[model samples]
Target chain A: MGELLPLMLQGAWVTLQITFWASLLAIACAVLGALGRLSPFAPLRWFSITYIEVFRGTSLLVQLFWLYFVLPMPPFHVELSAFSVAVLGLGLHIGAYGAEVMRGAIRSVAPGQYEASLALNMTPLTRFRRIILPQALLAAIPPGTNLLIELLKNTSLVSLITLSDLAFRARQLDQATFMTLEIFGLTLVLYFLMAQAINLAMRLVERRLGRGRIKGGLA
Target chain B: MSMQQRFDDSPMVRPSRRDGSAEPLVRFDQVTKRYGSLTVLDQLNLEVSPGEKVAIIGPSGSGKSTLLRALMTLETIDDGVIEVDGEPLTHMPTAGGHLIPANARHQRRIRGRIGMVFQSFNLFPHMNALQNVIEAPVQVLGMSKAEASQRGEELLAMVGLEDKLGHYPAQLSGGQQQRVAIARALAMRPKVMLFDEVTSALDPELCGEVLNVIRQLGEAHNLTMLMVTHQMGFAREFADRVCFFYKGRIHEQGTPEELFGNPREERTQAFLSAVNEAH
Candidate 1:
């Protein structure tokens, strides 16, 4: 039991790193995908739709296997390390769902805000930056937090690609010790704790965004 | 010929110089706007001098709001042109001196001289009163933060909201929100201001505060004002001329005393009596 602790902790650390890096990448992809989907240009919109549908409609595990297994073959000799593949696969998968969330939030901004920005003579870029984006973000955060938690959970899938994440480490420890219950139970608690941490951080962010306004108790 | 050539070739009715009056600050030259088959503004022609105050009053869907909206460039007019300070708004002059549909850049530059207040008092919800007032100056006009804040403070004080600068739109009452919106518009130092039912959304008690601020603005600034209002008493006192609109056209217009006291047209009389009865 005591030896199981150190190995599990090491696995948890790798899992945390993957979640943190993948989340950053996911946010960038979501913003780009959402804006591209809403863009006036037809080619960009089509590309965004295709990216979203292909990733979201397909299985995330298959997508991960393809990145890790298939890419190093002939014709498409793209080689990446296991860690890079893990982050890229999880980020792209969650980003497709986040894009739809962001698009809906942007569209939900009241027409009056656009009109007011127009009356103030703001350029399209300035209007989005100063007025539209801030309001849209407020509406996006709740749904975005959900997508992020799913991203955190999805990091467990990287164990199959030879990455020593929490799930992978627990299995390895259980095989060596033949004590499945103790190691697997601890792994479950660690994941729940990490998810709770995400919820706490998101609540703080919602509070910051909602400062100076009447508290609606949305969280 | 294209519609552009036909409009350009038509004889221009230049204002008479013999009268010694100044050129009109804003002109609508046979402007027509339609939403599908329904015409909202039917061949509308109106002029406003540099310092004039014109009140537009009409029943619902009579194009009273649409008139101000077209001038603000919120609604596109189907035919004819709108001009501000002797420059065409809906159309731009080419190198050959022919008029063509104005682009976004042209519209933005021309409409910079105008500001509009909506019926809903659409203040930015995320910003406090002071931020709302100074946002346009800092972002759009490229004014320095210090300079814009000073201007914003003065405008808020002028509108009797100095103490509430830190309050968000949700925290402020409807009247205070409207006043903040007014300050926001005035911070741009617009030459023309359009008030589209500015007090319509306020409670009856709250409307007095907003109307008082507007009255003070009229006395303090050299602004050309167009107000679409339901408040007949305020129009009577504040407007230089009152236009009674019916069915997308100005059916009658005159000084407040002439129009309100002795409306010549029967439709005007009927509308006034109906409004009077509602009160």
Candidate 2:
């Protein structure tokens, strides 16, 4: 148990790194995808819909496998590290879902807001940045927190892609010590603690944003 | 009968005879608007001179609101030109003698000179009353924060919301929120103001306060104002010219004495009677 603890901590570190990177990538994709969907240009809207559908329709495991295994072959030959592939796979998968959440939030903002901004003669960019986006961000936070927690859970899948995440370490330690029950139990607790941390961080953000408006609860 | 005689005998609001050569502040030159198969406003021709207060009263679906919305550029028209301050707002003229739909940049540039207050009091819920008034000035007009805040305080005070500057729209009463909306619109110093039933959403008791503010603005300010209102008394008292719209056209328009005191059209008489019954 003493020797395995150190190895498990190292694996946890990798899990944290992957979650952090993947979360950032997911947010970027979500924002771009949402903007594209709302854009007036037909080609941009089409490209965005295609990207969201292709990522969301397929299986995450297959996507990770393709990124890690298939791309290295002759025709594509676009090799990536296991860590990068894990980030790309998880980020793109969750991002497709998050895009709809983002679009819905933006649309949920009252039509009166757009008209008021127009009456004030605000430029489109100024209206989005100053009026529309801030209100939409508050609306998006609840669903966004859910997506982020899901992203954290999905990091466990990176182990199958040869990434030494916490799940990977748990399996390795169980086989070595033959204390499968104790190792797996500890792993479950570890994942719970990580999720709790995310909840705490997101709650603080929600509180800060919920100051001016009335709707969202503190929890 | 004697009260009616007295109202008719009182001096009417004289129409402004501004510089004879100056263009009207707003002109809807044969404007036609549509929504799919429905024609919202059909070949609507109207004019508003600077410092003139025009009240539009009509039954529901008579295209009264659309007329103001068209001037605000909130709705697009299918044909005809909407000119503000003698310049086209809905279209821009090309060098080859053609009129094309104005782009967003051009629309915004023209729309800046007009301010609109909605029936719902469309104040930004996220911002306090003061911030709502200052937002346009600081962002669109590029006024310094200090300057905008100073002007914002003055506008809020004008609307009798001096103490509620820090309150969000939700915290204020409907009447107070509408007043804030007025302040927010006025902050832009628009050459023309459009009020689309600004007091319709307020309680009956609350309506007086908003109307009072508008009355004061009408008496003191030189801005051109167009109000689509259901308040018959306020319309009679405040407007220089009262237009009774029916079926997408001004069925009858004249001085308040001429229209409200003695409407010539049968539709106008029916509409006014129905409104008076509700009142």
Candidate 3:
């Protein structure tokens, strides 16, 4: 039990870092992807669609391996750090999916809002910033919170990249002490706790945004 | 003959230059707008002096709302020009008199002067009633936060929503929401205000409150309000002038008494009678 505490605590630190960086990347990707899909240009729309489909179509493990091995090989003299590449792969793989989520959220803003803005002669940028984005982003949070929790689980794959994340540390402790079940079981508990916290945070946000009573119905 | 104007034949539209007043506040000159072959406003011309509240009543698809939308620069007319407060919209060309490439900046400048309320009360769902009213003044007018809040509070009070400042659109009743929408438009302190069937979506039970607010606006404010509504009673009671639109043309227009009580056009009489019967 004495040895178990340090191993788990150390492993948890790596897990925290991984989750932090991954969430940041996911949000950045979601914004870019959302904008790309919303772009008037056909190419941008097609490219965004393609990126989302390809990433969501394949397995995340395969993509991670491809980034770590295949990308670094073949006449490339640079030896980029595995940790950086792993986060990039994870962010890219998850961001494509995140972007689609964003697109749907943005599009859900009613036509009435657009007409209202037009009447005021609001510039499109101001219209989005003041009127559209805040509402869409608020509406998007409940669904996006679930996807983000899913992202935390997939980030376990980053352990294979030689980073000392929770999963990686678990594997090390299992081999050294010949106690695989306990180590792996503890890893699962940590992930479960982390995911639960995320869910809780999301619920709080949902409640805050949902407090408003919509002024609807025709006179 | 080449254009359709609300005031093409009307004595009111011919605000004479001899008076030495400011140039016409709004003008739609020989403007032809088409939605991919469906001609909405064909060579439409209309004008409003600095202080005129023109209530436009029309049959469906008669382009009443489109006229107001075009002035707000929400919908662009394909040909000819629209001017707001004497500034040529669609931009001035290199040689002048020709239309340049339409840019959002130009649209914003023109639109800033025009406030519009839509058929649907399009309040920002995320923002509370107070924030919605405070948006333009703080964001577009660049009023200091204190000034914007002060003006916003006064506007909300005017709409009878001072108690409901913290309430979101989803939280308010329809009439209350529409009142907030009106207050939101007025928060801009615009040169012109457009109401496009604002009460069309309301229940009859709930409409009177909003109508009463509008009547107050017309009676008290020194405003140039262009409203497209089917509320003929309100049109007659509140409007200084009323214009009847049909097949993309103003078929008849005059003082409310002349247009509604003693409608000169046979078609208008039939339409108003039918509307009166339906009610």
Candidate 4:
């Protein structure tokens, strides 16, 4: 039991590291994708749409496999470590979903904000940065938290690519000791706790952003 | 013909040189606007002199609000030119004397001279009254935070919102929000202020408060003011001139006394009588 505990803890550490790095990457991708989608340039809008649709349309497992195997074998000749591939696959997959959420949030901002900024003679960049983005960030966070937790769960798929995540450790321990119920049950609890932690952190951010903001008004 | 040259060229007309004389501050010359089949403004030719207070009154869809909006550049006109302080606003003049639709830079240059208050009171909901007032001055005009804040407080106080400095738009009453909107516009120090039915969305009791602030502005400020309004009595008292609009044209215009008391046009007479009966 003690030996199994140590292995599971190590696996959990790997899982946490993947989630942390992947979340950062996902946030960057989501922001860029959202802005690109909304951009005035036709090519940028189309590229964003393509990236989002392709990632969201395909299976995450297949994406991970492609990144891990296919990229190194063809004319592309791109090579990456298993951990890097895992991060890229999870980040890109969840980021596509986050992009849609962010796009919707950005569009949901009242047209009056744009008009008021225009009346103020603010530049387009200034209007988006100062007025639109902050408001959109507030709208995006709840759904973003959901996507983050989904990314965490999706990390389990990386075990197939040789990343020893918690799911991988749990399976190995269950097969070696025939302790499937206890090991798998604990893995589920750990994942649930990690997801809850993410939810709590996002809620705190939501409250901070919401400070002094007029919400759900006649506006 | 290059895009770079188009954007880089200086405006043919410089900043206004009006010294508050008989010079027209805002001129709409044969300006036409249409929304699909509906003609919003048809060859609308109107001139407002420096420091003049003009009120446009008309029934719904008579193009009164559109007139104010066109001045604010909120609604683009289909043809003709809008000049602010002798400078082209809707069109930029080339060296060859041809008018082209003004580029973004040109539009922005002219836009800075005008401020507008909407019927809905578009105060930024994310910001407090003071923040809303300070944002543009600090961001667009490059005023230091300290200078903008001081000016912002003064503007808010001028609008009688001294106590509500920290209140968000949602926290303030409709009249209070409109007053804050006025202060926000005033902070920009615009040469022209357009009020588009600013009091229409307010309660009857609340309407007086917003109008009072505007009345005070009319008396105190030297800005060229244009108002699109439904308040006949307030217009009679506050406006230097009243232009009655009908079917995308100024049907009649004169001093408020003459326009309201001895309306020359049959349409003006009918509109005034109908309004008087309603009140």
List, for all models, the DockQ compared with the true complex: 0.51, 0.40, 0.58, 0.58
Q: How far is candidate 3 from the true structure (C-alpha RMSD, Å)?
A: 5.1
Model 3, span A65-124: residue lDDT tens: 777777778776446677776677778877888888888988988878888877665667
- Worst lDDT run of 10 residues, candidate 3 chain A, spans A210-219
Give the alpha carbon lDDT tens digit for every residue of A1-219 in model 2: 778788888988898888889988998888789989999999999999999999999989899999999999989999999999999999999999889998998999889899989889998898998888878877888899899889999999899999999999999998889999889988888888888888888788777765556664111
Interface RMSD values for the candidates, listed in order?
3.6, 4.2, 2.9, 1.6
User: Model 1: how far is B126 from its true place, Å?
Assistant: 0.9
Q: Chain B of model 4: TM-score?
A: 0.92
Error of 1 at B76 (Å): 1.6
Model 3 over residues B1-279: C-alpha lDDT tens digits? 211253365433445488775457888888877898798887877888767888999899989988887877777778888887666777654555466865777767767788888778888877788888888788777888888888888888887889999988877888999999999999887879899998998888889989888888877877889999999888888887899988777888999989888998998999999999998
Listing every candidate in turn, what is its Cα RMSD in Å to the true structure after a full C-alpha superposition? Answer: 4.9, 6.8, 5.1, 4.7
Instruction: Look at candidate 1 and give me any clashing residue pairs.
Output: none
The better candidate by TM-score, 1 or 3, is 1
Candidate 4, clashing residue pairs? none
lDDT at A130, model 3: 79
The residue-by-residue lDDT of candidate 4 on B12-52, one tens digit each, is 43444467345477899998999999998999999998789
Chain A structural similarity (TM-score) per candidate? 0.95, 0.94, 0.87, 0.94
lDDT of 1: 0.90
Give Cα-based local distance difference scores for all models. 0.90, 0.88, 0.81, 0.89
